[model samples]
Target chain A: MRSHQTVVDSRLRRRRTAETVFRFFLLASVILVSLILSIIVVSILWKSLPALKLSMIFKTPGTGYYLGKRGGILNAIVGSIEISFGATLIALMIALPIVIYLNTYLKKKSFLSEIIRLFLDVLWGIPSIVYGVFGFLLMLMCHLRASLLAGMLTIALVELPILSRAMDETIRLVPNELKEASYSLGATRWQTARHVVLRQALPGLITSTLIALGRGLGDGASVLFTAGYTDRITTSLLQPVATLPLAIFFQLNSPFPEVQQRAFASAAILTLLILFISLLTRFLGRKLSRHRIK
Target chain B: MDKGRVLKKEKGRLVAAGLISFFPIFLTIAIFLLLLIKAFPLLSLKSLPDLIFSSAWQPQKGQFGLWPFILGTIWVTATAFILAAPLSILTALYISDYASVRLKKWLAPVLDLLAGLPSVIYGMWGTLLIVPLVGKFLAPLFGTYSSGYSILTAGIVLAVMILPTIVNVSVEVLSAVPAELKEAALSLGATRFEVVRYVVLKKSLSGVAAACVLGLSRAFGETIAVLMVVGNVPVAPVSLFSPAYPLPALLANNYGEMLSIPGYESALNLAAIILLLIVIIFSLVARLYLARLSRRRDR
Candidate 1:
């Protein structure tokens, strides 16, 4: 009896201590990663702080031998925003409806959907640099050539899988009973999906779009190849343009330290934009859940 | 009832929506097709075995061998798998089965943040920190000239990159194994180690395999990090210390300048096409496995 009791007690103690240790390990990894992120952010900020003057932010980099004494990352910043937004808009326009279609008209098309899903996975798994090669081919081929359009198209392809899958997962999370209720009330398949299901899934869909946007912002290799870098404002959408990511890459490669400083600033800004998008999703997600709880 | 008009309108709209969806994906495919067609001219080669098994990859001279790059990709990816899988699975096991509820909640997001970081940042960190560290301690191990960039450098960086992917997916799959299954194992007087190795792992084996494969794919597609750390030596690697070039790194580094060379661009595209084929194969396999998992879950 005593031995049995002692065995059980030891087991309980072991379990308790084991749990504590496991949690500590997980906590440590998290803290370590978070700390690293902060350090990166801070280092970038520190390096680039001297150049964050309003003039520096607004004026473009110089063209001649005075490349280091630039005013701002004006063209690159604007171009990044334009290209990323352009790409996300094109992607969402295309993917959102398909996700809806898969949920509604194509619910029974599981075989086709399965194939498409697999291909999307393949697309996502491809490295960004390959897209650059494809972009060159697209430019070399014909009318739909290199420009912001090509860059956006390249990013659109990259973000498609992530956003569409996010859309599918989010759409699936909408309760079946809600769909059943809409259908029973004499709503068409499209009507129920557009009105009830979509309204309910709006938050998730928006969040997915933001995440895709954030991804587009950070992805460099593909963007650099697709959208050839330029210092000046090229109003023609057909011509190559620069994005912040490409700027970061170019600057990192440049021999000048000042160029490197600009890269850090651009990276810091990009990181901030990404984190903002992430925080917005979590905030909105939490608020929605809290409202539901209430 | 004016149901006929509504039906007509919706049918039209649905068609339009489907077309819109088709167009962007078609755009993605169009890019793929262009890449495919451009490279098709060069890919008509000697023998498939010679292309794959011959230890040379000097496609510039019309030699289509890929043994070195393929072997490098596999060896580095495998090394990453070896390093990351054990830690991630153990971490997942500890979290889902061993940790208390409150602790699990606290740790999940931390792991997620680690996973959420962009790959470029990993490249930056590896270049700045890992490369130097390797030169200090590990260059002597493989008889290198204290060049910090090597296969070993890549393996460590890639291991960090794949940890989140393995852990998150494994946690979900392991948790999905029926609670009753674990209880039954425990009721039979099985030790914690025995239950994990036998019951939980066996039931989750397929899903775990998917996670492992996905990790391999993730490590394989990694470009910027490997480019920064792998030393980009086109020469065949004789040791972990030897610099190597995966296909993605080769194309990324050489493509821009190679475009000026007549056949060089095509050669690069040939390499790109090869990478695409590998991706498609793994993707189909993983998707089939996932579909099976979902179907089993439904049952």
Candidate 2:
């Protein structure tokens, strides 16, 4: 009896020690992840503080900006916004309808929906560099030069899968009873979709749009060859556009400290824009969920 | 007249939506076909073995071996997976099994934000921090010389980028492990950790594998962040400290100037095709696996 009790006590102690070690390991991993995230944000902010100025957001780069001359990143800021918004608009036009069709018109677990979802998933996984290559090919075939129009179309393709999938998941969450109620009122499928499904999914739709927009804004590879960065901002769709991502890439590559500083500044602006969009998504998602019927 | 016209209008709308829905499939096919067609010249010019096995990459001399980039991608991706898998699994376990309700709620959006941050931002951070740390500290510690831009730096950056992806999917899979099984294990006098390790991990093993595969696919295709920090040397990486060039980086760096060299454009296209194939295979396999896992669980 004494020997058995000692064995049990030792086993219990070993198990307790093992449990404590495992718990600590998990806690440390979480802390490490949070630390990494904070480091990214803080480092970017710290690096950009010296070079970031309000004028950078309001003025275009002047002559010899790459040589560490005085200038601003207005061209990049405006161009990033324009390209992303245009791409989001295009992606939304196609994505919203497809999502609506999938959720309302198709039967649950239908073959077509399954295949479409798979295709979107694959597309979403395709690298931006592949999209860049595809976009370049399309441009060549069309005899189009690198321009804002080219950038917008390319980014729209990139955003399409992401936007549609996000919207699809959101629309799928709308309770079936709500849709049935609309149908029982003798509403046509289109009316039910337009009024009921769309309204219920508005928050998600907006959130997905912003998400796609943020993605579009941050992508540099797709526009590396297709967008053809320029110093001055041009309103024409045909003109090559400066974008924040490309701006950072090009400036960082320069063998000049001041220019590298500007790159950090561009990075800061891009990060801020993405951060704002993310916060807006959370805020709007909660605020708009109030009217949503679960 | 009213009912007939209304029905006809609804039918028309359905047809339109259906056609629009086909766009994804069509786009997928188009991308594949276009890449194949563009890559055909290079595929025909060089024998498959020579192209894939040879490391010679002189564009001016019509040499376009892809072994270096392929090997680089493998090295970087493998390192990333090594570093990320354990951390992500542990983080997921913590989130699902250990975190309080309030902590879980806060962590969700935080992870999402991390997921949604632009790859360029990660690249920038990697360039500023990871590169310096590797070159200044890590290289000396290992008694090696590095230029700060190396495969290891890229891997560390990529590991951070893919952490959220693996963790999110894993949390979902971990959470799906039935509470009853955990409770049963607890009643047997098992510790929470033991229950999680024995019951939850056993049940969700396949799902977690699928999640890691998904993260691998993301790491494979990530270009900008990897491109920024990965020393884009055309040589195959022999060590963690060696400069490496990945396929996506190869295409991103060269496609702009490929018009000047004969067969260069085709070689770059072939690289893109290779990248697309790898990413598609990994993603489809993982998605199908997860889909089947969920179906089986439901049953």
Best by TM-score: 2
lDDT of 1 by residue, B104-155 (tens): 7767655655565566666666766678878877786646565888888888
Query: Cα lDDT for residue A63, model 2?
Result: 86
Q: After superposing candidate 2, which stretches have Cα over 4 Å from the reference?
A: none
Q: What's each prediction's TM-score? A: 0.87, 0.98
Question: Can you give the DockQ of every candidate in the order shown?
Answer: 0.37, 0.84
lDDT of 2: 0.92
Once fitted onto the true fold, the runs of candidate 1 whose alpha carbons sit more than 4 angstroms away are: A1-56, A63-67, A143-145, A233-236, A289-294, B20-33, B45-65, B100-108, B141-144, B184-195
Docking class of 2: high
**Predicted complex 1: DockQ:** 0.37
